[model samples]
Target: MKTSHNFKLTAAAVMLASALLTGCNQANSSTAATKADAVVAIPVEAVLTRQGQISSSYRTTATLEARAEAEVISKATGIVQKILVEEGDKVTVGQLLAVLDNERQQYSLNKEKAELSRLSSELKRMEEMYQRQLISADVFEKLKWQFDSLQASVSLAELALKETEIRAPIDGVVARRYAKVGQLVNQHATQSLFHLVSNQQLEAVVHLPEQQLAQARVGQQAMLQFAGMTPVNAELVRISPVVDASSGTVRAVLKVANAQQQLKPGMFAQVQLQFDVKTDALLLPKRALMSTDNTQTVFVIDSEHKVSRKQVHLGYQADNTVEILSGLELGEQVVIAGQSALKDEALVNVVTVRQF
Candidate 1:
């Protein structure tokens, strides 16, 4: 009877302990539910979508060239007497550049002039004789022809004398000089004297991909920058209709006014061909975008600081800025930096806001 009484007491005590453990579990479950309701805010950098200017352009490289250039050569064969201009001297068309040995040419011109003077007097006397019937028509005609021939010889001699002087054929700056004093140059021989280039206007020929031909047009504005220089204004002046089969490119010509003459002929330049432009465009910094699986998205923050993933359509992209085509509104807050860790409905603690 004593054993049975102890067993019954133990059973009652076990039941009380089990009931206490179950109540504790219920209280812990309520506390866990409360903890689950609290959400941590993610820190992010955001920006406001705003209206701005944007442009679409194609980039290419081209070597600059002078629009006007010439190779100065000697037209007469003679020893170079004096060099009037050195490399880098400015010259105009018809400007005397160099003198040649003209003693021989001068002597020939004087001899021809003396003979022509004598012939002129003789022709006058013969005409007077013919009028008096002292000379026949055939004889007078022969004498007149001789005078005309001598006149032609005098003109030739005068031209030969002028050819001894070298002149600039174009307005430009002398780029190179090949002739020196006492150097014998032959007109028949291909001897280069000086090279001149005009930098008032410059040209750059760029090869555009066949795909860009449709976007190219005359009078289009562009910008060009050399390796170590600031960008300058340029204009599209020409486009070749034929496409090169080997390279699959179309030839394009860009002209730039170099009134300051700061650019050179062979300098490599980066060209930005502006095909389209928008003055009032809805834009966002390119950093505000998330690219996943080839789909572009942005995390937009609502009034409650909760972020939602929005699908965005993009248009022309300029430096660091992209045009928003759809799926966004003006003045909407978007997470730019620190958005990689965000998801839909995630609470955000905005750290910084900036404008593009």
Candidate 2:
């Protein structure tokens, strides 16, 4: 009886041991499976956050104009006798442009000159008579008045003769010519004979929105770009004081030096006005920022190859780069591409590293 009782006890102990060992092996297998599932790394491209310079700017459409423009008109009236210049001719101020018929004016001036000579001889004789007391003071004074009137008439005739020549009023390139040889032109018609433009310096005219008036100031640097041309530098020259009632905007003018005469008037342009610049700013590539539900976040990678979403504050944005005001450090790696599959505390495999 004692041997049989001992055997039963040993058999019960063995069964308990076997059940515990099986449970322990199952737990180990479950742990291994979980680790294997979490070890998969998300492939991503990343960039190192850097310190650099950034600028805030505004862009607007503008039209180029000449430094000075004028509509030229003739002051004399007669048949056009000769045309000295054509369109696109460069002329100086007071340069003769055309001539009118002056034959009648010349004849009138010669007749007036002869009359003045006769009056001067009579005045000399009258003065002699007055000195000898043979004529009264009133008679001498009347003869003097007659001679002065003839002299004035001759001066008027000379002025009329000179008016037959048309001259340029400003130094510029002639843009148009409305009169030709043998064409009749009149002074009172109120028509422009030529369009003159001074193109040594070009100007860009733009209407800035009223909200930007505080930032727009004279002497600021600007950049101008046109289709099929390289960008050029310009300076802000003028700003309108009053807002335009029709557009609710202020007019700003930028001046550009065209020493080589490559820029012409009436070219459409895109102007970039720089408002502010920052040096040594924390910057990141614009693609690194992800916007979700009005919230901006950046995926930052750690030394262990894990990514975490970090909320950031942004400052000035320039081109493809953005200034990071907070929540990021210089030299930290941020995922720039292949971010769609990333999550918090996710393992990542960096395929490429780029410098911002």
Per TM-score, the best of the predicted structures is 1
lDDT of 2 by residue, 278-346 (tens): 889999999999998877799999999999999998998988999999999999999999888889999
TM-score of each: 0.85, 0.80
Give residue 268's lDDT in candidate 2 (0 to 100).
88
The lDDT of each candidate is: 0.92, 0.89
Once model 2 is optimally superposed onto the true structure by TM-score, how far is the C-alpha of residue 102 displaced, in angstroms? 1.4
lDDT (10s digit) by residue, model 1, range 124-227: 99899999999999999998899889999999999999999999999999999999999999999978899999999999998999998888899999999887
Specify the poorest-scoring 10-residue window by lDDT in model 1. Answer: 33-42
* lDDT for 215 (candidate 1): 83
Separate clash counts for every candidate: 0, 0
Model 2's lDDT to the true fold? 0.89
